[model samples]
Target: MGFLGSVCRCSGALLAIPIAVIVAVMVETPTVTKLEGGPTFEAPADEVPQDATEASKEGPAAPRMGSGSMFDRIAFVYDSTNKWMSLGLDQHWRSTLVKDCLQLQPEDKVLDLATGTADVSILVGQQLRTLGAATDSVLGVDPSSEMLRRGVAKVESSGLDHVVRLVKGDAQDLTSVQGIDAAGTVADPSAGAATGSIDKISMSFGIRNVPDRPKALAEMRRVMRKKDSSRVCILELSLPSGETFLSKVARGFITHVVPLIGWVATMGSGGDEYDYLERSILRFPKPMEFAAELGRAGLPVETITSFAYGAVNLYMAKPEFIGASRTLAALQSLVRQRSVELLTLAMLREKVGKRVDAADVDFSAFGCLHFWIEDRGFGSEVNNLVSAAIACEEFGLHCVVEDEVWNSGRLHTYLQAEPLILRRCPDEGTSRHRPLEVRRDRRVATPGWFAVCKHAKGVSFAKKSKFMRRVWRYTTETRKRIDRLNEELRLPPKYIALQVRRGDKVAGNRKESVQITGMDFAREAQKHLSSSCSVVVVCTDDLTAAEEVGRALRSLGSPAEVRWRSRAEVPANLRNGHWQASYNSLTAKQRIEMTHEFLADVEVLRCAEVCLCTFSSNVGRLVALLRDQRTVSLDITEWTND
Candidate 1:
């Protein structure tokens, strides 16, 4: 009665169907089309039907894993064999794949590769249809035409005839498939790769069969959509690779016992040839190795759900950030070309701490503008980072960072590129890659200080916008944090943002803190705020200053609804990881917490209708970079940030 129950029943019925004939019947539910300008989709001889003499002439491809004719032999019995070998747990593994892919949108299309009799294909359709996702044609590609032929019938019988379609193709190179486009959109079957592509991919129990595993993975990366949630769910049969007792037993079952079960299932129907199944399973890479392979292909696995004591693994992956390859290739080329000796913190600690002179370092592999973010005020650090990144672009030098210094060495963070932290000891056997030591003037900001370290002729701003738009784009975590901050502040459709600075700012020069700074912010807000703009959000380090601003706004006879965040509201159960610089009286934990608080506050400031603050402070100057002319510095009569 339930939809999933209906799917299981349909799968059961299809599994029981026998391949009594290769018919001339045209199935209305499924469509089959051949890929043009590529290899023949037919399987090698040893695996094809006896009647197919032409394909048999091609001889059997030595790699049994990729042998389509082999799968064709077992096509009708494949699902049943899986049920027996997996102890009826094959469905559970696919259900996990479905669960991971539930983030799909209504308009997104899913590709099912190695769709034997369309089990995973139909199941995905059933699940997606339940969610009202478009299942009009969930395309399934396979290497063996026989496997696809049977799979087409299964799709029709499952009541997903309107949803699933099967075609013969190679996963190693989808480009070989006819009518499929390479431009990342699913197009008409008549077009080649120029037309379009699929959004998500699900390949169940077939990755092991692909002889060129990395190539197949790279093909997956090339065709699928690159949205943040666009994923590839690959269910692979694997050997149990653990030291646990249960793992050992599962390992034994796969190696010593599964082959016998498979042979017995064949009932002497080419039983000796079926030994290839055991070989394929044994030759399959371990879970970790496969995950690394996935990484190398630019599809980083997000989760690996293991089943049957690790006999199977469900890999869910997301595309690596776009242009990451280009960024790195560009950096690698530059580093090698310029002979810049890039050094990491470990190398630094080994040689010198805090600061090192360039004259003391040896010349080597690459020349890079080592981007640095110091433990200064949060505003100052980001300004330094952005400034240096742009500077790297301006000079056409390799733009990279030291590993320990990137995002302050926090894991689980995100970046546009792989961050390209160039670490080369070249030959610890002969070369110690000491850092490009700069005589840093501690008071100055980075890449500026870094520029001086490089002894640059000067700096330019031409590359600033380009670097910010493409290279220095914010991570999803950052966007999430900003959104959270906006929601908590309850930002209005129209409201001016006011910031009051105290602490070090008050002691710096003629600057004021506490109530005076708040008064300055409030007065500036009045200049930008008409009666029509009657809402103002105040951000401040000292609550006492915020209190002053609210009072000043009211005393100015402005009808603005004043809102400000308390120190207690700053930290949320958001990002699990963050980089904090140790300073003042705060403990390490408190320091990190405060960093989170500061980040949230600045994001709220960035979202303001108009900003009012002193440009003399780094926070005020940062507002100009984020929102440009929409900000005003109360200390300066003119609008200039200088």
Candidate 2:
């Protein structure tokens, strides 16, 4: 079931040669850089006592090549080995697609069309389960029994039998009659036999193998549930397009190196067989055109995201009419108008903590919760944390900083803000800065003898660099003063935390760079957010960051609400909340967790509003999720700025 034999299952060697040669000539040569080294060399290049001139000799390593189609045949040779190789670049592609393409569910059923050993199906199944899907959610379908056998074996070996199921049948012919048992089969023999609508339908790599392309697509449409809530997904290899210099380089690599690797790996099988691998790639349709085919087949494409520099792409095509929205357009409109912001499961513990109802707290009269660290020299991290809290408050959350014992000069660092809550004055003057005190550090007191500041200030104590010694020292003192003030004021249970990743310029193994990467707002907001009343809504690009804040709040026995940019949407019951927004606004972790919520929110809407923007991470997920929710966009340009 490896690359050597994956393509062999498609056609015999004799018939595969002619196509291979023609494909080879048309196939471009892969460029390889040649390097030369002398025979044996003395230590010094300039002058070695005019004595030694032996040179060392070496050449560039030979290029290894393989084809996209080699993957299909290699399954026949050594499936396990080929599976890992094909997945080298494919793992990333799958992760991106799962996060971007479909609206997931915990228990929803998924049918993987053209399963081809059910690799794609299994991959999808694994992701779904990780996102909290029920184990029985994914099913695999393939035309080849040999391919199906490998999938079955994999499932049994992994003990994932309940999560993934494989059925042998042609993708083009999916009817009950088409499932001929070679003698005793009872499934879809008519091929394309309708199997009703499923939550998700995925066809990866296998689509190109089908002889009747249009028929296979049509069968996909026929079997798909007519509801506006289902997903029809397609992931496959594609050729590069023009207008860029790198385009030629990429083309060269694919045509030459790919086939070369195939020859080396599948040599005994047949060079021509591997040659067909090159032809298939050359002949595959452009992504846009392929998407058009899907539209024609009745599963119009909703999202098409390319990966690996366009070597592969994932297409999410939903049925024309999902649920009540008889047309794809109708579904988009419905989801936009009827999306939810937050879905919360408010909890209480056995401990007897005082209950604060959100309804009873008059924010206007109460003003705001004043939380400030005690110091003149401020901590950058502490200030950032408070800033985040302020931002959350703008969205209607609450926070408080308890401060009493103010250490002069340093207090200003912790108190600086938009409102300038605290003022500066001479220590001996009648106008004391505090509730203030005096500090001997003139470096901090130069501005004023005593200065008022917030009980909570930003600080970056986590930095390990030697340059931040002064800041770290101030942060430590500020925290100590805060503890003293909290005890003096007898403040209620509170949560104080910091976000340390604001300076990360790039993500691990990703292309985009994150800005405004702080979880402080969510952390501080949780302190005052009543465990029984107000919900602490955490919106951050990092879900783990938000969760950490939420966990901290939870430990204090407070109600914390966390949202991610990757989350699908609020469940149907929770859609009425005003917080409903796209996942792009939150962290990746939030988006993932929210996907579970969206999958569970299956309400059919009358009409939905549409917001289209350039396909950004969160925005893309939003569009995909809303489409699943049954909204149709008349045009995608209206609400999106980009």
Candidate 3:
């Protein structure tokens, strides 16, 4: 009988014997012939000879024999055999392995190890092409020359020979094949510098065939870049073991049906090889255990996903450096301290080798905007900050709010924290560096000129309403507090929101502060309170004004309930000096609480049926910017009924 015919014919007899005995017999069998009177070995014409047994006796650290030679005998029918054995699910699985597991990027340089017939390499090339990355290349390496020869033909036939190259190489010894450089040009692999130059490395259904799996894994890690940008993926068949029906069904098919299909496909030439496949699947480690093995190989597994009832698993990992933990901790610390400017300067120095002239750098390419905040009250500063952010976005720059602005009451709560790049002066001891020019001769010149100048102050609010609306999102804690307050107050369904600016505005400039009075607010509230059910919601910095507005509304015979925050509810720290002074003096925790309260008040105003307030109030302008509801803003002089 032929080699595969004997294997199929003996399958029944082998099943009658204990599995342990069968495994021992298979291991002891001489699959290759040793040359007479020499250490050299020989196998079939297509089979690659390995001296693993001879090498083992020379020292205690001998290399393990792999199943590459076994695959060499079945290379011609490997792809067809897999299709039949997998019942046509192989292609679907491979596509998922490429599209999802590998996640090929447009510029990625991929390395496919044990690329039996370059199926994975072709899929990768196709994915890259779909992503409009025709310049990207895939290098496929396999230990079996016959497999590579077949793969080369497939590459040519698919018209991907330009980007997909197949070579005769071992997974454990990847130093032989040329690798792509940073400029995407092929570099000499023999120079040993190509290691860690690859953007991604993938092994599909091939990790199982390697003899020294850990060493092969380490070589894969060595070929991937050390940064998180580089990823390694492994897709391998797994043995199902659970008591579920699917697991039992898969187990039976892998042990019996898979070998039977292989026997028929190769015309009984690959039954023994398929039998080895069944054994290997059963011997392979579990997903978690294999992930641990990958970790030991210097590729810390990032994600592991199983497919088809755990019969197949995909492992995605990145090269782990020894100091990565420390580096991450330090980076987090720097972020908390808002030292992004210093960090950015350090990175700039590293890239340029030395400090370059600020004029030489094109700041626009960095996608960031930097500007100093004027030392002013919270409300004025916020108006400048928000306008600056809006101007930055309009000019195609991402606004990076200063740490001082981030610590303010409402501004900190509303704006996101992004890093800003500060230019360094050539003179190390110089106190001042060149600031980004927002204006030229007191006129707005740049797109983000509004951030530094007063031009187009409300342009963002008018033109970019959608952008302004999304600029602030209440925190989960603040939202919950607002919801609780809303429930407690049981606010009227139809009410008018009234804002009286008194505290700081009256103290600093009575012209701006006393523009509107309690009687003026009561008269405006009456317009909305046409029915007894209507109510008036009052928000003000002055407790006295809030109380006087409630009395004036009642005296006007308006049945609408007058609701306002009582003085007792206001924190004592927030009641002193101008509202800005009180706000600036509060502790961080107290500031957060005050910010939340302010946001809640704004929320009420935003949801009101109609809003009436003085034009000079920042809260009134902010509310008008956020909501489309009817808003009536009277001048400070009009409030005096003059």
Candidate 4:
């Protein structure tokens, strides 16, 4: 069986092995820094022979270091998942490993053998591109057809296709390969760069997946020059044995929670995929055991560093090159901050295009998308929509819009705080409240054509609260007031509703206390109205402030209604329901459909005749992305109130 297959098969048995439980109960063991030699020998010190009894009584130790079967299984899973699961951590791990490999020579050429998705290949190609390497110079080789197709699409889409090459080839027999240099110089011009011509070679998340790990390792050694110090870095997940309470909890989460997540993501109906994940982790060799494989392969392990409570590890080895590791120390100081992933249903709608078909849908595009917005006001809803829409249109990617408000300094803390925001969103009427497992039903209702726009933005505490209060009232009372207005005046949809606000009254910017700048524009809009338009409905948080501006604009002979809806007035106003509402409603997903029918009864007083809006407002950006009509940006610089 392949490495991953072995892991999947052995996961249940490994769990039963009770390795972590034993370590958890035992006191912390002091680790000896053994850089000077191989693993400390307690039993007979002579180099352990290849035919030693298998560690497990049931079968020969899982295709010992450098075994071919180990990788074949990984390739199988890689083919099955189509490379969806484990992408985030996989990318981060590869990036650190690539960084280590590149330290060999700022300009050295590197090959990421068995490079699934070309994670390592892309990094190496980037280094060559930075040095101005030509197309067809840097290459990535893998055996999986499915993985290659996806990797090729990514390279082409990223505009890196011209520089990086993704090829299907075996790592065990790479003695005949060629190399590309910094300036696109290929030694054997006919068949591409010649064999034994490459510099550094590294594999990430692939070695453990390989079957005959030793032969693959030795093959890597044969393809490089002897005098040249070839560098190779391997990064993989490991369950390190230690007695810290934190590590024990982390082990439990990995053994249990991780598989559950894997099940939801891979096998949504829920089946054996979760078992695959748990099995893979448990069946995975402990850190020292894996390092011992590199020794067998002839690429002696030089150093090992733990990351994320030893859940993952970065192992650096020299096929021949070994020196006091400078970057290893740097890795110790670097900290990983927690970031929430967001997806917008609107964006997903856009990516899947006008029609939704499971076959047409490329689900792999939905990797984790991070949401960031400058303002968390009503303006945020619009901005969030735009970000999601753009991502879906451009990347065909689905996002997980996180409801994150507070910033925690550490990754673990951020994970803990995420649930708080998710819980608050539904109560605020932003989206229906659902735990992560049930949140899929809360997607925003969008047009059929908009299905591809699947990006998500997190709502902050202050903004989400404000959104809930405003939405509840808007749907309930303010909705009715608009209905009454339409019944009384019989307004047309083409009429305009103008929202104006003072810049001074807005909240302070989170990172700095600088005042926002949309107030002046609102004050200045009165002078430039076209004679064709009438009856501007002004929206504002402060009624007194709205009237002051309304009176000033009225002085210029404009016919507009000046009114303010207090936070309390919303419920009553929505009950009247005789008026038209904005295209985007703020009601919770569950309640909105019923309210939408009421909203439809009211005609839009205006179709939006040249909207004068501030750029800082979320409403402004929303109008920019959604409204098809011509709208003008209300620049504050144009305002001269005097």
Candidate 5:
């Protein structure tokens, strides 16, 4: 009538002898056998050779029956036994874990522990392939050689040998394995020794078998890339606890029918192993209790999903590390909680360090010059901020822009490092902690409020060079993305960079002073289009202007090719006076993409032999500052004059 009753009736003593003998014969058969004349069968990496030709030539040897816990004794029948017992739902469950739960990315590296027959590992490779990731990204590790041997055969049969790998590994002691160091860092020749490299870890019906789950979990956390991005998924059998009828049926199947079927499948030699599974299921902690254990093991449990009326549970977690991002988020929370007055006082104390003479002390706060560009564009804002930082260096005050600004602006995005800010303050929150003051002129100065003053004149060339050097050194991620873009573009060896300023510059107020046309930019570019120039790169906010310059140059019969972001590539929001509005309206991801485009354009301009542009554009100024190439400013008057 029910599932367990049917299994019990079918698995009686009558069929045991023949099934046992078949399983015995299967277990005794060597996965790899010596050939008569063909090349010797050598295991590739941790693979067990399973050539069909070798199997036909050799007779069944001896069954590897050892201890009660030995998996090699049942490796040949493991998948079939489980499939029969679970009614062919084991594969579906594993696939659900990979597709629904893991959601792996293209660049992710997976670690599948207790990878019995590499079923879960192969599934992970399949899922990654769907995400446009390479198949060779998954590494399946297990302790049983026989299991890995069968896994190798399945991998070869499926044509997934290039994508997935099987390795002999103990989950509790993964540090001993090659490519995985004592530090738990995964090293691969293709991916390199990426710190905290492993992206997702999946253990299916495996954690219950591991003697040291806590250590195994710690190992998972150690190899994971980022606490915020990486996940650990554990799927295991559990005893049904609910009072529902289905729960009772599931319980009966696990407690009685599973062991009986396993016993018949192994032909009594390995039947006791099935009994251990039932006992282990009953011994495993409840979902909540297991979640607590996961937390104790240094992983923050995210979700626990139960299937088959609570007979199986999948536990998901991520590493819980107090990284720099978390610290900054906490600091931001603290800033939001406290009043501005208290924050100012805390910052003042942090800046002064020692007691200050209140009378003669100039109360000045160093920060990004956000208030300097009330009527100016983005470039003016950045130029002022850079000047302010230089002035802060000259005046011996710590630049506080790093602490206060949270916007996705040029200064915050481009600068490699930020000035240190005061992390803590006194608990009293009163003037009693303040230094004594003598009578004198007192004023609280905001760094951003002060225009680039006479003090900025003292900023030496060496200091400017040091600041620019640090600011220009891009982060590793940014550099990689830019390099990929460069490869995709395939620019010629020699090129002339042109920065054409139009849009908001020639529209609205002071249009007369900033008036410039596409022909104007084209004429300026023509001056540098010599026989040696291999290409022309035009960076412009206005798509029409860029196209006009391209046509003008083409009509002149210039030998060099013109390269620029196609009109389709540039988002419509970034064109004309709507650039700022569109930028503000963009989602976080879109904003990041826009920023990358801007930075990439700057990098392209930096690589040019000669730069031609109006000084009014910040792109031109930044390009001139970064390179020693001859720059011709089309605008004769100073663009900084307001």
Candidate 6:
């Protein structure tokens, strides 16, 4: 099914989001307080661990740290208190969060959502600078105006004004973070970083403060770049999930003594908010529960790590590049829904035709294997070839494309990809004239989806791209022809492109493929377009829709001469998603010529600033793999829980 109908699926799941870390100004060291039968901790004289017995009587419904006023009172000593409370480990935790969890790249644009006193923001800026990031890459957001006030002063004092920016915004909602979009640079800082703009998000010591944690989690996932290396790293204070002696001791210390440390560090000026820290830890969901919560929020946890006797946890979630592929939350829903059929296969893995498992094979019995070749679009044919490649590799079986497939029956004759491994069942060859018993081997007909599901692991984007390029390799003449077309169209060296997939619908009573309609690929493309986007190329079946995209791009009049190939045209029958069907009825020479034209279009689609296309189309998916596994899939998953 195409994603045009999936709008509700995504919108129902997403609520516009939060990353919030509140920071406190550091203070001088204070003397440690002596506890009975234990090491001394520098805590308030008026409070002790014994007082925590009453805290147990306190309900788990601790007040959520929504606004920053409560933290504003403790902001003065937040840093120093954390250092002392964690026995000088808090600094290391933050550093690890930045260096390890974030894994910041030189080009990454970061959002430290709950930046208090701008500690994380400052760290991110420094790391980004070290990486030689030329862009003003870090945006610090927090709701506490007072905390932001101090953070601004720190950011300026640290001489990172060109790198880090602090804005007043809530972790549960980012729209309030001034104007911070992709173009809303330091010069125009009011625009909040737009959705799919941020590469990394860091929330250090902020999750406890968020009442609507799922909302914040979903928001972070929303704002993050929908590509590989995108991450949301949250370092939260957690309770020990063990009953060991050290675990018990650490638990008691964190629950009872940490609050008093806040009180002592701030000299009772901190008010009762320090006690909320203990309550936040208590009210925090258990580690597994929180992990589940994250999955449900659409930020599927890729890594969960515990530090310091499980008192602190770093929860790392990364959004998949594709349409929320096999997320833990989605799998769990399936498990719950189909517990009885847990052993049953998904309907998508339908048996296309015959099956061939090599392990059980005695291939010596037959000389040639039967492969079900069909008349389908070039995308579909390539998909089956990919499937066959994987199946052969996994089964240790040699494949031969013998039959007339891809409609014209001699489809393989037109294709230039002479795979070293796959043998051609040639029409003129002696092998073609062999006896029936000498030719007939085992049959192999693995479905396209089945192959995808089975051979998913270890096939990285790089590997997949290399494989597809090999399968669709161009000849010298083909390259020359494409270049000639590109020059005639006056396409730029590097510019944005759109792949508007009208989906696969065949002619007559032939069971039609998925139909795609009423999509907004241009909307997604517009988000990434700018004055720097000098040229845009639209690759689509429907030139009518391409006309809309061309108008939209040209409407943003710029000094950088915008150019688009608007005179592009395709026959109505071909444009209606039946190119393969029409080609089958054509002569062999016409089929070859049509193949060349299609390849040129694919080559253009293969290279773009961004491939704004639907995941519903096979060609669009193929384009995604080639675009370094990055593109606006335009899947409507954001509107639904899927």
Best by TM-score: 1
How do all the candidates rank in terms of lDDT, highest first? 3, 5, 6, 1, 4, 2
TM-score: which is higher, 4 or 5?
Answer: 5
Q: What is the lDDT for 445 in model 5?
A: 23
Query: Candidate 4: minimum summed lDDT over ten consecutive residues — where?
Result: 435-444
lDDT for model 4: 0.45
Best by lDDT: 3
Worst-scoring 10-residue span by lDDT in model 1: 31-40
lDDT of 6: 0.58
Regions of candidate 4 where Cα sits further than 4 Å from its true position? 1-34, 37-89, 104-107, 175-195, 227-229, 268-277, 321-642
Cα displacement (angstroms), candidate 4, residue 574, comes to: 87
Judged by lDDT relative to the true structure, which candidate is superior, 2 or 3? 3
Comparing 1 and 4 by TM-score, which wins? 1
Candidate 1: regions farther than 4 A off: 1-65, 135-137, 178-196, 332-335, 338-642
What TM-score, to 2 decimals, does candidate 5 have?
0.39
lDDT of 4 at 241: 43
> Which segments of model 2 are wrong by more than 4 Å?
1-73, 77-87, 130-136, 177-194, 322-642
Q: What is candidate 5's lDDT per residue for 548-625, written digit by digit as tens?
A: 778887777666677776534457867643245346456756656666666777778888888776676666665666
Of 3 and 5, the candidate ahead on lDDT is 3
Minimal lDDT window, size 10, model 2 = 341-350
TM-score of 3: 0.40
lDDT of 2 by residue, 559-625 (tens): 5543322332333332322122232234545433443332222111111122211222323222333
Across residues 1-642, which tens digit of lDDT does each residue of candidate 1 receive? 699999999988776532111111111111111101111111222222232211133345444336777876776567688777776667877877776543556676888888777788888788777777765647788777566776777777777866766666777777645322222233344421221367788898888777666667768877876677688888887876544455566777777767777777878674654577676777675564566456556676655666665777777777665553454445556665222222221332333223223322222332454544434465655555555444444444444443332233331243454332223223222223222322121211222343333322232323333343343345697657546655666777678887666654463221222224556667778888876667888776566666777898789877778886655643332222121211323454555456556656666677677878766666676655566337776765343211
Residue 628 local lDDT, model 5: 59
Q: Model 2 residue 240 lDDT?
A: 61
Worst 10 residues of 3 by lDDT: 33-42
Error of 5 at 103 (Å): 0.4
- In order of appearance, the predictions have TM-scores of 0.43, 0.38, 0.40, 0.37, 0.39, 0.42
